[model samples]
Target: MIFIYIIVAILLLIGLLLLDFSLGKKNHRKNVRFLDFESTTGDYQIYTAGDPLFEDLFQDLRHAKKKIDMMFFIIKTDEISRELLEILKQKAEEGLQVRLLLDRIGSYRINSKVIKELNQSGVEFAFSEKPKFPYFFYRSQRRNHRKITIIDGDVGYIGGFNVGREYLGKDAELGNWRDYHLRLLGDIVQHLQSTFFDDWYLATGHHDEEPVPTETEGEKWIEIAATDGVQLEDVFESLICQAKEEVFIGTPYFIPSERLFKCLTDALERGVNVKVIVPMKADHPLVKEAGLPYMMRLIDAGGEVYMFDQGFYHAKVVIVDQQLCDIGTANFDRRSLFLNKEVNTIIHNPRFVMDLRLAFLKDVQDSEPLNDHLIQLFTIRTKIKIGIARFFRPLL
Candidate 1:
């Protein structure tokens, strides 16, 4: 009788979760907003490694004259993040506006004591996407995966590098972190500053000051594309469909939706070269396995796939025909496509695009091709893992 009662309780819990998810999905579908900002000019500096990126970012933060706004999916309570927190505290104590926004579930490791310290120092801090009643499960699953920083309306930082020791290649397990980050200077900062304020409003329910616009321009042109859980698929689809010569994708996760998979295959059929690079190391269970089927399908369709071997490939980049590059926090997975709030920088500068392409090719050189020999090594256990991954694809 006790066993039967336990089973009944389990079923009831699962039913409740399903219902919450359904309700959240309906609400999310209704609130989907796709933003297309006007093209702006900025001078950009790209960072592939973490140490220099942090050094420059920290310097910029120290020099902020008026405001510092930062939002990230994950911020670890480690050495690097502690340093950043200290910086923000100092800035806020100096009477400068300093606000930090972090995802609720992603930055769970940051304890209350740290937050209290920041608050005491006059730093405005808020967690985005807190779970609510009637759709707790769904809200918990959706995340704000964008990483952006705006300072003084003159400079902007956007990319995939989170605040952590691992991001600085200090983790023993995941050695040598690899990612792509961009530092922009000019009128483009206004667009990203606007994004930070909008997100800040959503997270804290408080209106912030208007962005301070700069009248600077450079050769590089960019558009900041933002998606509210939905509409990202259409953005990616449009980019892929417009590919005329080749497509290069680099991401940590590669579990594409059915429609997205079809888009890739269709691109291949139309003689567009499609190449993808993903990490050989699995950061999360079932995520690597979840991408196996999709990777195999791409390989079978004459697309080239490479597994990054030097370190974890945490970059989210897509290059089309050496003319356009999309780089941001969104992964090539269902979460980024249909659930997470994501922002991507679309670059239309030929010089920058060509430079990024060369960097992509260098990483590809450091990768191993997914050929027949690698596929032949899969055992029955691997097959079972793939099945489990497919079952939990949405969560991954």
Candidate 2:
């Protein structure tokens, strides 16, 4: 009996060690391919609806063979929105594994009828955790800011596009909302599928089987990194630090953490030509207020900052050294850094980065430079509000 006990203990120890080793390997694997969007996914389709991309996404949904997993921050009820919802319901009724996760805050305005309809249709759905009480204090800040859809574990879509009529240019007020969405193909879809599964399990307490590999011939390397919970590995921070010559960034919001702010200032001090473009009229008023002081700091530090005048600038992108770029749903703010679940793809190809640079230049033509006079004109009341907002910036 004593000998058997010793052997069992030894076996358990070995098993734990093996488990740790496997997890480490998964975390450190070097299968990441960094191709620019054009070179990475060759002969791929581009859509600017009423264009092919929009139609292709729907067509992909219509032809899903095995499964469809989707996660979004918001899902509004509009014409195009309802059509997509109905298609999802049809797919679920057809015995496909359709999973949907939506942020409670972003979709708070969605009608209960839509929720009931989806549930009755056998479509699995979950609302991310809502604060029990004191809702404004806790739940109001944290958001699941990822927009992703994976089909058959072979094709994936990620970027700033959300599911709403406005996103499709169908809303009267928000008809011309400019945004971006990317279609991805290749081995990277597995990572996207897994990411969706992880969020699904957290929301619905169910897990799908591991995705099977889909065969595709490509040399474009891609890797996705997302941040959630309190523990994150700061992949965005590392990407920013890797910039050597130029860093071009665009976002709808700009309240960055102190560490990130300092990093940008240090990079500029080291002679990097750092440029950031944000909107002059933000969709969120408080975010705009919180960004002013930081924008002034960046300007004083010799960083070039532009406030886009074109209708709400809702893109979140970062191009580093004109060789690597990241596009996704994360804004450069405290909310995105610590509160929200954000997804970003790091691409290491020059052609893709150059294309993004061209887009940025076109946007700059419509942007107004951040000048010292603007910073000096803040009224006392506005300054007070900004101070309070900055004090609670982390919670936001």
Candidate 3:
């Protein structure tokens, strides 16, 4: 018995050491740098609304002399997707290299006619890793939940908004999907392009171009961080740890990991005003049920929680102390933290931070307050369902 105990202890120590080493390497990989737009002492223009965003992106694609790459989790056959496809076809015809990567599961319902048309037009496309078995297990659950667009290594865009009518406020059933996307113009575009290439290679087994960090003659401080596999241990935790006074979070899903839950609770206890906004009518019933227990705990700890009652709230944003902001496709749920390939940009700009805070305040106005009474209104059966859902939250 004594010898067995000693062997067990030795194994545990070795496991811990391995974990620490893996975490360190993951952190190093997570550190990404881009030219800061706010700090750059140069002339820049700010564009908002779907029309402007699409216009700029199309113009870039039309004039692309080298490369155009795009990756999206979902790309419905809506007006936006049609316009994008037209532009991509035109670029391909002009002899510009155009590549598209879409998640197979998210774009499962995409119109086959549109895909066939694009293929005939000479545009190259690939779906994120296909499942080994289609009808047996939950293989499709591991999705490439990233939305990125890069053009000629000079411009890029990343955020939660997918290429669909719902994202552009056209889906009648969804009413209006509130989301956020950022257009980046600087060295960071290289990283965005590289991310797309990695996914493309994974899917098509083809190597296109390698990303080389671009040189910009301006001062801009930007960092791109992502979480996937075992690489998530520090990215989200570090952002939470750096919060000083106030933290504002907006996400569609709220099933957080254990360490993240504790960090938010601790921050609230330290007198930090922690506010979180989630969708009242979630698309996934299981996620809605799994999120309630965490909501109750947060409310009990004096943390502010809001549920957007207007439409589907799909933005993923975190503003810390009104000085730093992280905007991307990553949610606060377990899938984003541990399973999905997610990307985020950390910006240390007062202008962007202030604008993001203002947007959050606008969203808060449309959100309903969550409290204990609301949570207690569920029936016993619903409560049992919720409990079971929570048990599988991490897996979901």
* lDDT scores in order: 0.90, 0.74, 0.76
Model 2 residue 346 CA deviation (Å) reads 0.5
Clashing pairs for model 3 are 36-220
Name the TM-score of candidate 2.
0.83
Q: Which candidate is the best by TM-score?
A: 1
Worst lDDT run of 10 residues, candidate 3, spans 34-43
**Regions of candidate 1 where Cα sits further than 4 Å from its true position:** none
Model 2 clash count equals: 4
How well is each residue in 26-61 modelled by candidate 3, as lDDT tens digits?
Answer: 543464222222222211233324566667767878
Tens-digit lDDT track of model 2 for 229-297: 232236657767887898888988888878888889888977888888988775665787888888889
* Candidate 2 CA-lDDT value: 0.74
Task: Pick out the ten consecutive residues of candidate 2 with the lowest summed lDDT.
Answer: 31-40
Q: Rank the candidates by lDDT, best first.
A: 1, 3, 2
User: In candidate 2, which residue ranges exceed 4 Å CA deviation?
Assistant: 1-53, 133-140, 169-175, 229-233, 377-381
Task: Estimate the TM-score of every prediction.
Answer: 0.97, 0.83, 0.83
